[model samples]
Target: MIGNYLEFNVFFDIIGTIAFAISGAILGCKKKMDILGVIVLGLVTALGGGFVRDLVLGINPPNMFQNSTNAIISTVFSVLVFMFFYFRKNFTSRQVLIFMNEFMILSDTIGLASFTITGMTTALSLGLDKKFLLIFVGSITGVGGGMIRDVLAGTIPFIFKEQIYAGACILGSIVFLLTRNFLGDQVSMIICFFTVLIFRLLAVKKNWNLPRISD
Candidate 1:
């Protein structure tokens, strides 16, 4: 059971890393950043949340430094995105921008769901049984990287003002906590991931946003 859980956790972590890297790379390309900037943005978006989570949990060195696979994966993907954009004949075409925007949303949603699972699972594996802490860590791991990416890209983080982003992660964490014991870790993770993914997609489609003071 422990081995299975570790496998699942690592699987989801890699998926999240790839998705976030692509999203960050897209943002970098759109921002007209060079290859180095794109790589930096991609790596940050792919690993920043995990790094922060480890710091919060007092895990020195963090997993990224301990294992370089994720960094290499993110860097390779970022370079691919840069090359694709750089070599495109119509890099600024409206249709291409639209497609990239759509792809970004898909990647971001997948990353959000995948990382939420990884965060909660990591917390549980460490023998931390506090529900609130699990949820908090999960939410941070799900959204922290994207938040940093947006700030670096000079835009307000989507979680703060756009469609239900962090809210979806928080809710997903809740779902995992509620179902993990009864349904087991794997099943609970599946439910939690889909919960965030569907909720985020629906929010995007419906233009859902929290009530603002002025709005």
Candidate 2:
């Protein structure tokens, strides 16, 4: 069903990988991890979601291991992030912290949006037809990496505490599934991507949050 949208899938996959890698690298910097740690964190955050998704779908070895392109991309970007901070020696530690916080949010939001669509496309391409399963897989693909990154970084997963994270992905998946037939795959994918992106950004901007028990 999604065969004709292969180009869109690949495009979003790359975008998502790069964005997630950058976000992970930034988090590493915030944690004061070494360069190697930064790269490892970035790789995990960029690929962890797909790793889980493929494993659940029974794809042995997973795409992250099957191909080296995304891995290489993640590594290069992680190193670049490290170097970027390294060379900005004039910036105070507080300044760096502030900048990283803002930039990480932007990259993570983009990654969340892009990967949500890619996850749905992957399920659709593999002939999965159930709506709930598609949304579930897509949300996993969108947020799983960040969850792993946070855990490895010794922080609570933001999706559980921060503004609408996986919820944005679920909504985007629903939008894509709803619009795909009428708008066509490419258009629907674009719409879905932006839907998640905008929703996430707005959540951050407005400090939106689901109800939780008062501490």
Candidate 3:
């Protein structure tokens, strides 16, 4: 059903899953998790967002679990990422840590963008009409997995910790809704996906952040 309209979306889904899986594997390694634990984190990070969204929407069984494609994809990527990190064995080096951290951030950002668009498209297809629900669903699909991954990894969630994480997702979701009337569905999704991606990248590069109260 979803595959029909999501001609190119499935591809983004695979890429996003791989990206998030790698990020999860990196975090799991940082937390000193074993291979099994790392794999669990990767799977959760890849699918947790959709799981939450489905539960909220009463989509029993969830889409990822219904078919084995995404699960298999995530698992393979997780194992490959874990092996790469294991073989490297240089986490202590400052340069190595910096490079790995940057890479993780980049992967996370890509996943966030891909998932945001996917979520909005899915919600629209589901006949969900409210703007808030669309944004909320999109945001959840974008960051829900990362939230679970961070919690399991014993660190602050990126959506909460990063400068403009969920904000970027929200903005992208809004863009999708706004452009729906004026643009084709495919074009709208692409615009929204890039909106989140480019926005997050710019925010990170420029150190843009929401204001925090005095400490």
Candidate 4:
């Protein structure tokens, strides 16, 4: 039952949201933005995707507004991340910077994977069993927040750069829908999450990218 997976769903969403929120905060810091600007970017990166997803689905009053838990999670993590980066200059060394970069990548991958599965399953519940819509929504939900953050930060979104990030989402979504009927929703979601996560990690390691046209 959906209720049985409630904790499971919330746990992943929280982890994903926190991850993305920190990514946004880190970007904001890099952009030399103030604390408030970092907070805004972080929250936007955390919830923008779900807002767009719910809005497109015509679900009035998106869950981001209705659910205070995600908002609190986003705000708390965003602020904490910003503060950590802001204060680490004097005491922290080069290793800390390397760790921060690695942590950001790790969290971003988790966010991408978790959101892809969450969005796909949510669409399925709404009776959108179509292949294209499920994949579209799933991919959008995974990357939408990051897109918003990047645009607001005056940079190109990651997906626009020919990275394999969204591609991983699309593939995972398709796999999730295909397996859901036979494997059950929870099982499908778990598989889909790992699919995207592993795929992106592999792509990053291999330096994979879409073929870019001229210079």
TM-score of each: 0.97, 0.97, 0.94, 0.92
Q: What's the lDDT for candidate 3?
A: 0.85
Candidate 1 lDDT tens digits, 1-215: 56657888988999999999999999999999999999999999999899989988888889999999999999999999999999999999999999889999999999999999998888878888799999999999999999999999998988898899999999999999898889988889999999999999999999999988893
Model 4 ranges with Cα > 4 A deviation? 90-96
**Model 3 poorest ten-residue lDDT run:** 1-10
lDDT of 3 by residue, 97-212 (tens): 88778988999999999988777767767888788988999999999999999998888887766779999999999998898778867778788889999999999999888887
- TM-score for candidate 2, please give it: 0.97
TM-score for candidate 1, please give it.
0.97
Candidate 1: clashing pairs of residues = none
Q: Which residue pairs in model 2 clash with each other?
A: none
lDDT of 2 by residue, 1-215 (tens): 55679999999999999999999999998888999999999999999999989987777889998999999999999999988987887645787788889999999999999999888888888888799989999999999999999999999998999999999999999999999889999999999999999999999999999999996
- Across residues 120-194, which tens digit of lDDT does each residue of candidate 4 receive? 667766767778888998999999999999999999988988458899999999888788788887888889999
Alpha carbon lDDT of each predicted model: 0.92, 0.93, 0.85, 0.84
True lDDT of residue 162, candidate 3: 78
Cα error of candidate 4 at position 12, Å: 2.1
Quantify how close model 2 is to the true structure by its C-alpha RMSD in Å: 1.1
lDDT for 90 (candidate 2): 61
